[model samples]
Target: MSELNVELSETERSFGLRQIPAGHARMLVIGRCLPQPIGEVWNALTDPARIGAYFAEPQGDFRRGGDYELPGFSRGTILRCDPPRLLTVSWMPAHGNGGELEIHLADENGATRVELLYASVRKRFAVMDPEVNEWAAGPGWEFFLDNLSAHLDGREVRPTDRDWQSMEGTDRELYEARNTEWVRVREEFEREHSPLPSPE
Candidate 1:
């Protein structure tokens, strides 16, 4: 129960539509700087043991073109792996639609700035609201990064579900505030960009 304080301002979020092989995909970009060296942050992200400690229990081959699964979460193939820098994968979640996930890491003044890009295609016949989608996905990534930050700071990390349930007091209040912030950001993004054309 390390203090669950997440600064929404620390994260840069954007929403747009991109063309993929399947069709038009809604792209969500979230970037935040972690106060740790680049190499240390990279290892925490790629190493199975380190990832399991902070994120989820990872299982499967972890090389380029290899398949991997984060039990009860998402499973997909490792599309590209460039150590200490970039890692791209085809992300197929246990629920909802699948997408492409890319992690970009860079050295920013001796600290690591990690950017996560997730793009999921709009279902052909299913109607979806881009604003709803952005807000829903944004907070989840923020939560994961919060855990990563705690882990980097040498704080105890807990399973996502249990950790979420255990949130109380200030932590719970901050979590709720984060969600509200996401809604505000999404609303602003929607006003700036026209909604995607309805699926045929």
Candidate 2:
């Protein structure tokens, strides 16, 4: 058991973090507050044109059961689309691995809260080194969410030069150790930012 951590931006109303369950699995959620109305944020996430401006080479269709391919990112079928509220999809990665991403939006105070839940990531590499596997998901989600937040707020979020630059040279044994540490802190962060009370 580890204490989840929170990393808040003093300069912006955005934050990101990770959560892991020992040797079982990991879940990552990253998002930000949009100064614009909920409808605008909804469009930015659901609109093909708006999504292309932030992530992927070009935006694909947004209808449920339709193809949602973004050049480099995994291509998959849209599982659900409840317009302005829920957008769920299954993403297929290059290695034949895939996962589901659920985007939820709600009106909070005056700003729209966008929550992205990237779950059930393939545990394909977890056996190799659960730690290293844990390493990839969080940062990857962070990168994507940061871009989404920036785009929604009319800011540009540049991709990092190297993805794993932060985890370069740590010993093999400590990889998972540090991963758990990050997971603990990240979970804490989510609890704090949660718009509603967490379900029991």
Q: RMSD in angstroms, all models?
A: 4.7, 9.0
lDDT per residue as tens, model 1, 1-200: 33443365778877666665446777778899999999998888888988888878789987888999987668889998898999988877755566787889999999999998877774431212334332245566777888888899999864575433356776556656666666666567668876764334
Highest-TM-score candidate: 1
Q: What is the lDDT of candidate 2?
A: 0.57
Q: Residue 166 lDDT in model 1?
A: 52
Superposed by TM-score, candidate 2 places the C-alpha of residue 186 at a distance from the truth, in angstroms, of 8.0
Clashing pairs in 2: 4-184, 4-185, 4-188, 5-184, 5-185, 5-186
lDDT by residue for model 2 (71-100), tens:
766788788888788988876666655566
lDDT of each: 0.73, 0.57
TM-score of each: 0.81, 0.63
